[model samples]
Target: MVRGNIRGSAARGGIAACCGLAFLLFGYDQGVLGAVIGLDSFRKEFDDPNRNLEGIIAAIYDIGCFVGAIVAFLTADYFGRKGSITLGTWIMVVGTILQTASFEKIQMIISRIITGIGNGMNTAMLVIQSALIAFGHPLSTFMGLASRQAEPSSFGWRWPIAFQGVFIAAILMFLPFLPESPRWLVHKGRIEEATDVFARLAGKNSTINDPDVVRERDDIVASVEEEKKLGEATWSEVFTEGKNRNISRVLLGAGPYMMNQWSGINCLAYFLPITFERNIHLSVELSLILAGVLGIQYFALSWL
Candidate 1:
């Protein structure tokens, strides 16, 4: 291809699109609850849930996510990126089903843990999680509100929760075709497979032996070799080092997410409509509508 020629394929763009959608799903699931939790039917179904109950329902997912991350870290080498995500996706589907079908708060809490474990596997940069919350929260709120319009029904909140199914379905469809992360391929010593995947990502007419492809693949292998030389790592390294204390880097890496959770931003993301209604004294309908507007803003801001 020419230096500036149009060069992208379904494989190339599809992977990006799938990643975007996956993150979107993550945000949607996280945010959807604020709206659902605020509904009259939901409150009744769960025995008039209070702020404390809301907090529990909202926070339990994080617990599950933490556990999931540990599992992912331990088993990542064996599962590969694609396999890990696929497994997480399946777990999420089960969690979604439970969350959607749940009538009691206990059931919902359990579901949250299961779903969170799945999400934990996929979590990365705090910004990405924030972006997901921003986009999905309001949409979910409105969906719950819409379902409630069919008054005298006890199942309204379930519809909004059920919407997670749609996102999961999309992921299942695209995930299999999405190329594996190059590092995982290289880690497993599948150099040729990694090369082909890299070539495909690069574009048409690119071959496994293409200089750019080969160089990039070698860089990954070299990086892995350097890591091997460093030998097995221990959690202790995160706190100690010879002269270069890794604790500082660890704290720096963790600070954003810690701030996000402790600063009340995440709580707000999952309970915005509730906050608007209960604290700001807005009517339920108006609160959700405004929350939807906030979601739109969050989605727009994510591109930056």
Candidate 2:
């Protein structure tokens, strides 16, 4: 870890900023293609792929994301939170580069999958900052407009895709300087380091043995120990109930997300501009513009 002097709320704020940037990047990537996919230039370049192909192009990223999440689930404990995040950021950088340079439909599909994997590894979003993803929609619509050149230039679409790198860059620049997840540290049996992190989080003058820090550290360690007593869960055990109600708890947590996919917000998020043009019979310019306006409203309202 790149140790720094920041402590208390300042340190916490820095951590929050990094996470916010990541979510913003995630939102931007999700929304950027929504408008771009509807662009005349993009359509022309890709030979106006049928809706079925477009769906695959749009949805394949989530497949990569699923793979990434599973990978993180299996490996995060071994890598630690910071390590996983750092590794994922680098993977995203590669993915973004490939995406921005894509010249073929296949290339774009592969690059997006790679990018999704990276985002999945880092996990998802924070509540209020989750709006950054929505905010990305408008920003992407604006950037997609860069393709309005009289002569067909790919710069508009490429630039927006490339812009994802800026968020990733911001994350990489600051992440190394911040502390790792203290819980992960404790899980790895590094109590002293975890204690130091808790102390640092507590305040500038706090020490590993500070009463409040010790109490917090001990509490976490105790929690970790208690969890270990449950033993490692096998797949069969996970699906069946013994003492943990594992399957029920899993369903409760996953049900909302499953319903969300069913709710068709993703339909709006991924295809709003296209839907407006094709379904509502709006002009292309008006569709893109309205999509952006709606994105702004989504961002604003998410705070509630």
Candidate 3:
């Protein structure tokens, strides 16, 4: 059977576009709640949840994302990159529906977690998770503004949550025509299929035996064989120095992300509008506008 039709840079571009949409959905979900959380209608619907409850409602998605990451870790190889993303997209759709229809705080929280899980799975399988995040935030902010301008009812909040479906739909549409990760095929001992993927990714002029395809295919096979010889590293080995400074390497790799998270940027990202209103003493309207501007700033700077 045939795989993806596109080849070379075109195929890579298609795959990158799919990954970009996935992260865009992630950023939209991250910022959409903040856009509407401070609204009178939102507060009224949830009975004016206290700061504690509000925090839970806002932060619970991360917990779901963590679980989703673990889920991806356990299942991504078996499902393959494309499969993991497709599954995650469907899960996000389900979660988005639950969130949009939510009238109760509990349902909203649960839905947020579900959405996070899907995002987590996608992030685990793809790169550049944050590259397009700024775009998503501003898009959500615009949606929130438009929905509120149209009607200051529940639709204001619900529409922002549901707008995520558009991005999810793009992913579904593009995924089928995209090739799975060639390295993953090699890992599964599907050499011929992996070669085909390499050929498609290399260019239309390339075949399975094309020199470029052969070199890459052989490189992946060698790398996979070396990994097989080392065997899978256990959780404990991650902390131990059984072979090489695994612990140090892990810390070096993870430290930047940990510090970024710890720097409270997310707190700002997730609650920017609210912070502007409550802390900076700005009006809600001004706060939302400023948040949107900040989101634009983030999006622009991301290119650098």
Candidate 4:
């Protein structure tokens, strides 16, 4: 039993590590644009002769972010975390390639929007996955440690984003071995499959059949049977029922969290170089380096 627990812990730790890599990718996607915009090549390619065009070009990525957020909210629950994340990664890969190769201002704008979609999807998916995996686990400890490593300059902005592709590739390589969420399995009425998954996660030896596993399997069956006695609520029913008011309350309360995106810290972070140049009289190159360092510090502190 001790050996089984140890193996189970290790398996959970492996999943946590993979989840942390996903978070790193999330941070990189969010941080890279600021660094790129500060580069001379970006300015020379997009700034043209008009200041208004420059501002418009710069805001296009944020517009993409809005689009991505809406799409993620609408689809992540329906498609599952892994599916959304995989799709988001492909979008990111395409966006990055487009941005890297873009010579025209319009192309850059389009690429930024594409990248924003990926970024938003990644953010939502990562958060949901974290919460789900951490539900019965020691989430704070795992996430706190992972969060410490979220520094922006840990690999510098551009390299971090580029490195995300490698991490995503690594995830794909190992995904076949990963078990789907048991909750999802159970919800789909795959009781036996879900039981097998739970047993595997609990590290049951192939030769040893445990009564505890049977008990757990029976409990799941009983719970599902009980749930069926009370009809499942539709989306509208969930909102209309007083007993389910907590769900609506929580959703309504999340407005403040959404508002944080527009609270100016991110805006400042994204346009740090431009802000420094226009307000503090720093050159673009120096401003980006400073911004990168500061962003790293900000991310590092979040872990603490």
- The predicted structure with the larger lDDT, 3 or 4, is 3
Q: What are the clashing pairs of model 4?
A: 152-296
Instruction: For each candidate, give its TM-score against the true structure.
Output: 0.92, 0.94, 0.96, 0.70
**Model 1 local distance difference test score:** 0.79
Give the alpha carbon lDDT tens digit for every residue of 188-227 in model 1.
8888878878887888888888999999999999998898
Candidate 2: count the clashes: 1
Better of 1 and 4 by lDDT: 1
In lDDT terms, which candidate is top? 3
lDDT of 4 by residue, 1-304 (tens): 0122333555566556556656555555444555555444445555532556655555776677677778877886566555666677678778877765666878867887897787667666554243322121112122222332434332222342354467567655544455555555565687776676567667636211467666776777777777878876577664563776856786688868778756876666445655776689896556655665555555555554
All candidates in order of TM-score, best leading: 3, 2, 1, 4
Q: What is the TM-score of candidate 2?
A: 0.94
Q: Which ten residues in a row have the lowest lDDT in candidate 3?
A: 143-152
Q: Which candidate leads the pack in TM-score?
A: 3
Model 4 clashing-pair count = 1
In model 2, which regions exceed 4 Å deviation?
A: 124-128, 146-151
Candidate 1 residue spans exceeding 4 A from truth? 1-7, 124-132
RMSD of each: 3.9, 1.9, 1.5, 7.9
Model 4, position 188: C-alpha lDDT score: 68
lDDT over C-alpha atoms for residue 80 of model 1: 80
List model 3 lDDT by residue over 1-304, tens digit each. Answer: 3354888898989988998998888889999989888887788889999999988988999999999999998998899988998899899989999999999999999999999999999988888647698788877877777777645588878888888999999998898889888899999999999999999988889999889889999999999999999999789988997668999999999999999999999888889888999999998888888889989998888888
